[model samples]
Target chain A: MKQKTLALLTLGIIFGGIFLTMIVGAWTTENTKTPARYTTGSAEGEYNPEDIRGSYTLGEVSTLFDIPTEVLIKAFNLPLDTNPDTFKTKDLESLYSIVAEDIEVGNESVQVFVALYNDLPMVLTDTYLPTQAVELLLSLDRSWSQETIDYLNAHSVIVTISEDSESDKDSALATNESKEPDAESTETNNTTNNSTSTTTSTAQEATTAPKTEPKTEVTTETTTEHKEPLIKGTTTFQQLLDAGIEKAQI
Target chain B: MSKLFKNQPKTLQKKLSIRHYVQFFFFALIGLIAINHTLVETGAGIPFLSDASLHALCPFGGVVTLYNLATLGTFIQKIHMSSSILMILIFILAILVGPVFCSFVCPLGSFQEFLGKIGKTLFKKRYNHFIPQKVHDVLKYLRYVVLILVVYVTAKSGYLMFADIDPYNALFSFWSDEVSVKALIVLGITAILSLFVERPWCKYACPYGALLGLSNKVRIFKIKRVEATCVSCNKCTTVCPMNIDVANKTTVTDLQCISCMACTSEESCPVPETVTLTLEPLNIKKPVSANLNQ
Candidate 1:
């Protein structure tokens, strides 16, 4: 083809492909990091742990892996008040940046935790989890090969859980009253206050709260108000009241 | 300014070619898409226009995600189905004419060429000849290395590793939060270098360009030089952006050829239909000994 025809043809093909994709409802532009499913083994058709992204929230992880949000929070030693629905797994990178330079305790750790919790097969990496996560995994009555336990022992990072004094007191109280099934949850929190009090104080100074940006509040009020008749240009007070405005408020 | 032009002969004013118009269209479209993407993120953009991210629009993303898609059954993060579709379409075009995307479509190539105009005026005859031909021949192969490293790393890490340092991404997404400092640095260096060189990135560093350049060897339509009507003036070689010796070659199968058609008879050749892009192959000349024996 000549340069002119080539140029036109190139534009036509590209635009045509895009238009066709849009018409076929396959033109995805959003950042949707959907985890890939396993293709083989007992976990066939199940979500692969390796496909877990840093963008996933703890709540999403909980739903996907069938793990409790509380267990995740406690295992990771996240602040007691943290909203699991908003807390991204990437926050662990910043939260443990001091130690992460040596051993990364971030999204990969979450993947490992989820895999072990569900007893699903996984490709092992150099990813490390908190000591509490290791302990929680060991306590489970699952089919734990000695090699896996040894691997967990070697990979466990002993990060001092950093929280304020009031949360520590509440954690201690919860631990005292906790039942058998809820024992690990309280113990994970209680360990933060009981041991390494000096290190905990230092770690508290180093650690910052995980930043969860406020979700954009979509306002429907403008559209709703636009649909309503405007009380203007000789409109009556009775008309305003009929429009759903209280007389006293008006 | 008067002294500069006083003794100089008046040259013919160059008009915009079909290629120039195509370049401007893509450059403007990509710029608008990037801005629209950011505006849409803030919930205040034109609703009808596409607000796809640069990653979503880039065919290179599709190239990088191939291994991950095959092995893991998923694309790299931030890349989507559109990238793969665009890749397929671009490859089809490449197979037909060879990397017309680089000359007629790439916004980055156009951006560099835009800077190269200023370089042409400043350096005059010396423009696009900053590097020695011998050194350039060796340096041009670096882009292949870059392509290999990018593909390998992206596959291993399951991330777009090149994104952090990609000058093309930085050029369009400089104002956005997604642009990395390393990418900005690379973009800045590329901009400054564009004032001295013609498409320095495409010559020595563009992984995508390296991938597309391979199409030159297998393209259907080829740039062929006629041995009979060819003037020895070498205008085709002088006008070549990639510094290819087009006048000497019977068939231009140079890997660096973007199929820009700059060296074609329609563009730079003094004789009509002498140096042309055609599906027909040039006649191979018989050797002197073979002709004598015959």
Candidate 2:
């Protein structure tokens, strides 16, 4: 109980616990046949984002997809010297969350990788990219604006030009309609989650523009058998589960 | 309520403990809402209210960041701005008082304290049971070890190594998919132990608590004993959740002192001015009794 004795005992426990966990972890790794959450084995299944956790390293994702290392770094806005193998996906998410919070976005919740995976611009409209682009993405698009998006999708072209050149063309061809997104349509946007929205925003704009087609094909995730009616993205998982979605599909 | 207050003024302590209830309610509600993903998937929404990503203003984040920066020469994550700012805020508060966050604000700490009350009710006089005094003393320092390990492993590896093992994160995130067996086991064990020991996680496991404990040693304001009006009554020590020897020490320099102010409360320490919280340095004595008399 003496302070000196206590201090020595404390140190013993501290070092002992550290040594124990380290040894045990190593031993477990050697003995156990458990697979890593992320590994290069596309034969197993397609890359599903749901399986992604904070433990998955950025290097793993890059390797899995054969994505350029610099592109991944640019997407996440990581330091140049940062070891991709050592840096986890959550690190990028954490950084994005901080920036998101700075912009008065939610607490650490923004999935920045979704943007990278979907091939949207690193940053959305009206925000600085966390880090400067180190390489060029071989895509062809004017600006992210609606008119340019419509024209590009009308031609079904890509964003292949340099950003400066594209932006110059965009200024010349861009429709400067500053109208707010209608709350009814914008607010009702449940199907286009972050990934889906960023990916389909251009195509959707092209089809929706010109107001020529009164009979627009509304792609919905509804079922005819359900009498009470179920909105696809809006229903809580719990409510869905209660409604027997768990028995069928989640 | 009026009749009860008039009959038992001492019960002011119980009434004042409403802050715990508020903290408890806030956490429980958030925990529930976080798990329920209806609002998030339901469609167009303001991103601020619905957060699905792991981590939300946990100060433990800053400790891991410090470790990563020190060990790896880079942040564990690219952006730790929120956590860095949060750590700065908490440390500043730690310097001003002791670990007031643990006692007043931390939902996890509050949850454990509430569980500790259940332990007290079950054990009665034997409620404050611990291991052998020497072993207990040693065991109490394990949190510091956890603190170091969490930082080192997180920094060395590319992940928040403590995430799966963190009881606080586990408890709040049970409804979330992040709940691992390790966290559940630790949380279950700690929840069980809380009935037998007060603030078991804070005293012997939490890395954040270990960091904040330093505030007791160097904080400007301290809980001091005025030996001039000396009384050896052990009421303060008995009430101290961290179990510091409050009565014996002339000034409580124990890093375990959480500044709950229970020792300085009127209900504790029968003699007024015997144990007082003072801003003056322990080296320079103050006229605490005169201030009390006035």
Specify the highest-DockQ model's number: 1
A1-250, model 1: which lDDT tens digit per residue? 5778778888898899888988998878654656888776656788877677776888889888889988897788765555777677866764553342345578889988887787666655456777778878877766555556545655566554334334433422223332344454355434321111111100001111122211111111111123234322134678666766676665
**Cα lDDT for residue B242, candidate 2:** 86
Compared with the true structure, what per-residue lDDT tens digits does model 1 show for residues B1-294? 765444332221367789999999999999999999878645579777788889989999999999988998798877888898899989988888898999999999999999887777667778889899999999999999999999999999888889999998999999975688999999889888988889999989999999999999988888999989997789999889998999799989999999999998888788999888888454678679977989
Q: Which stretches of candidate 2 lie over 4 Å from their true place?
A: A1-250, B1-13, B18-22, B25-54, B67-79, B282-294
In candidate 1 chain A, what residue range of length 10 has the lowest lDDT sum? A197-206
Output the lDDT of residue B222, model 2: 77
Top TM-score prediction, candidate number: 1
In model 1, which regions exceed 4 Å deviation?
Answer: A31-33, A40-45, A54-59, A69-109, A119-250, B1-13, B281-294
Give the per-residue lDDT of model 2 (tens digit) for B85-189: 456666766786667667765777788887776566556556665655677788889988888887778766556667778777787777654477899899999
Docking class of 1: acceptable
Worst 10 residues of 1 chain B by lDDT: B4-13
